[model samples]
Target: MRWTKYWWLVMAVMLISTFAVFAVHDEAKGPEKFGRYEFKEQDKKAATDECDAGGKPGPEFVPTVRDKEPNLALLKDAKPEASSQLEGWCPRRHCVEYLNDGFYNNCRSWIIGAIPGWAQIDIGDVANVNRIYFGSDHSQGFLDRTTADFDILVATSKADPNSDANTWTKVYTHKGDPISETTEFTFKDVEARWLRLHIRTNGGARVDEIEIYGGKDPMDVEPSGKATTTWGEIKTE
Candidate 1:
């Protein structure tokens, strides 16, 4: 009588246990499986992109001649003196000497009445010269004087500023104009070991400072001050 009652319960338990084993076997999946779905090509590509390296920026150019490069004139010894002078009211002696002394002040400048004065500096080695700048001597305190007409010359060897005018290449010539500030003159780059400034005085000729640019002479360079990048600058594309 008891066997008849227990037979249905044993059959039901065996069927339920077999169904649970089949459900677990279907649920087991590989690492490539997703939630309720097998990974497709698009999903695989997205996963690969997420793990890929970030994008980078292209290279940029930076110019070195922005400001006046360190004066190579300071590196060597070259006497700056007037080549020759005639008897005149204005003091032309040591005129170029004070001008090339590397000091820019109102107290010292070269002045001549009407005679054209020339000053030369031997750079001691061949150099690439591209530009020249001269400071105006019309500062207060000196007698009333007009600006001086000037010409810039360059040469590959030491040449007499007075005798070898034909041997040097003339780069720039300036008409007599009133100048009270820094005046800049640009020229094609030339190889030169000698730099000369020839001045023709108007009412009076004055030179407060002389600056030459673009020389093959080695220059002291400072480290680049570039901005830093952060996570925001990074990209995936």
Candidate 2:
């Protein structure tokens, strides 16, 4: 048990280390008619005000005490996989609100792409994952049609998700009406160092938040109901 815990901790540290090199700054442009999508004017004050007014606890699914450090896909190293986002209202290191809380502040929301936009994380090594969470800002409009039709893929290397030059596997898929505030998707479990999310919106896919929560082994988890630990073992939090 001691050796196993030590290994898991070592792996965690190694994975977390890969993100230290990335740094992001948020900025964007004026709105104009682009394709089937519409961009509202840059109203930072209004957006901040809405967040202050009605933004609630987001993706409040798995309890923290139970699912502590829930999301393994390091946001610290996350970056836009497409032509980037709409500057200020984009994905990347800017969407921490969507990851931690799916607040509907009416103004501030995260928009991905206009058909095939993606957000990916380099886990550094093969990691175990089982569940994923996705959310979109409803303050602007309903996301039922905007958030569906997407593929969850994983590749050994950080390759272009939209191209055939890379070796990628579609681990999980989603196609539904994302009418609710937030939704959680579960799968058998996939082990990979990289997770690439490819979303297909008729024009633009606007999702407020996303989370990838999972674990590696049974011996390392304290599942809902379990037996007491054996004697002579010192447990660490």
Candidate 3:
């Protein structure tokens, strides 16, 4: 009878401990929404009221790239396209053109409409790349629209302008919490003129910036958008 009592006591303690851990985690994440505007934590704040009013970016709203290396995805000639974007709701604020603009304001991010949509960048030339960065709006607030599960893909050439099909190779796959801040993914050097952020699952996903980095001269090729380029962008209306 005494042994049975001790077993029950141990089970009760384990259950209580598990619930306590989950409670702490939920508290750290904070609330998800604030007066219809999604809530995102930056520098560990409960909420940023300026973002609710559509205010300008603050001093902490710096570019995600902290190093001297140029963001190849931000080349002047680089072109971006997406499968679908949130239209009519916010006018030109949520267009795919803002995907690689090297900015982080809430108004400058792309809100993709499709759950499995893709945002692609053509660097305008074949470049050797090994690293990529993805981020949501740190200036305003991040919604559940921030990508949850996605893949980073690269292609040397494309058979169709509107279709990814079988032309691309996956470099990295992320399947966890939604990306609400700048995150980096690195792999072995791969040569390509096209880089794509493929979203698998999300809640009206938002993509603020996607930065591709290739170090040195031989590894990084400055794009010219010459006739020799393999892929042509599908114009987004």
Candidate 4:
């Protein structure tokens, strides 16, 4: 019986030793097997091809003059009228209405001229614009006012070319006593389709033109028509 028990113990030890060696071998080779399976040459080639096809550098984009022209088909032919005439001549120049006297005391303050005389335009499809320019006549005067305050509004409804009391969405406003002709006002990150100019001041002033160059120009459907009549026929005292 003692001899049989010793033999059984030896057999058990050998089996355990064999199992431990196999386990160690598997552990050592496990990483190599996994590496071979996880990373294939074909897979690497496919990834490289995809990167070369989709991740290639593109040329710099630019906006052309054709992109800036208004699409007459999408726009309403209706002209926008002035909602209010704070001062100046009625239907003065491009202004729908001019207020001779009232708030500013006959100082020739044209309130809310045409909404969006000029629009902001973007260089690329997705680039954010930072600058804008508006056309102006030196004779019409630069934004000169001792207490000049104005706002830029985005409107969903078309402006009345004959009235100045229309409702609009105010996108931006400048709150200062007044700005000099030499001073330039800069605005940032203003998103709007239709921009309106609101002027409130205690001094006489005029804005001949406005342009928005850096940002995306509100998608203008049509250009404003030329004025045929003088300022008197368009507004009343």
Best by TM-score: 3
TM-score of structure candidate 3: 0.64
- The models' CA-based lDDT, in order, is 0.46, 0.45, 0.60, 0.30
User: Candidate 1 on 1-237: residue-level lDDT in tens?
Assistant: 689779988999998975553221111112322222121111323322332112211111111222534333333354555655334322322254544444332333455434566766665565566665555432222324545466677766457647345567776666645555445666665666677777766555566555555643322223222212111111110
Higher-lDDT candidate of 1 and 4? 1
lDDT of 2 by residue, 60-101 (tens): 122221244334432333332443454554232234334333
What value of lDDT does candidate 3 attain over all alpha carbons?
0.60
Supply the global lDDT for candidate 1. 0.46
Query: What C-alpha lDDT, on a 0 to 100 scale, does residue 25 get in candidate 1?
Result: 13
Backbone clashes under 3 angstroms, per model? 1, 3, 0, 28
| Candidates 1 and 4, the one with greater TM-score | 1
Q: 1 or 2: which has the higher TM-score? A: 1
Candidate 1 TM-score, true structure as reference: 0.53
- How far in Å is the alpha carbon of 49 misplaced in model 1? 72
Candidate 2: regions farther than 4 A off: 1-69, 74-83, 87-108, 138-145, 161-166, 216-237
- In terms of lDDT, model 2 sits at 0.45
Candidate 4, superposed: residue stretches over 4 Å from native: 1-80, 86-94, 97-147, 157-169, 182-184, 214-237
Write the residue-wise lDDT of candidate 4 on 121-235 in tens digits: 1111211222222212221222332334555544334443322445344444567444432133344433333344455554334432232332224332233322121111111
Ten contiguous residues with the weakest lDDT in model 3: 228-237
Among all windows of 10 consecutive residues in model 4, the one with the lowest summed lDDT is 24-33
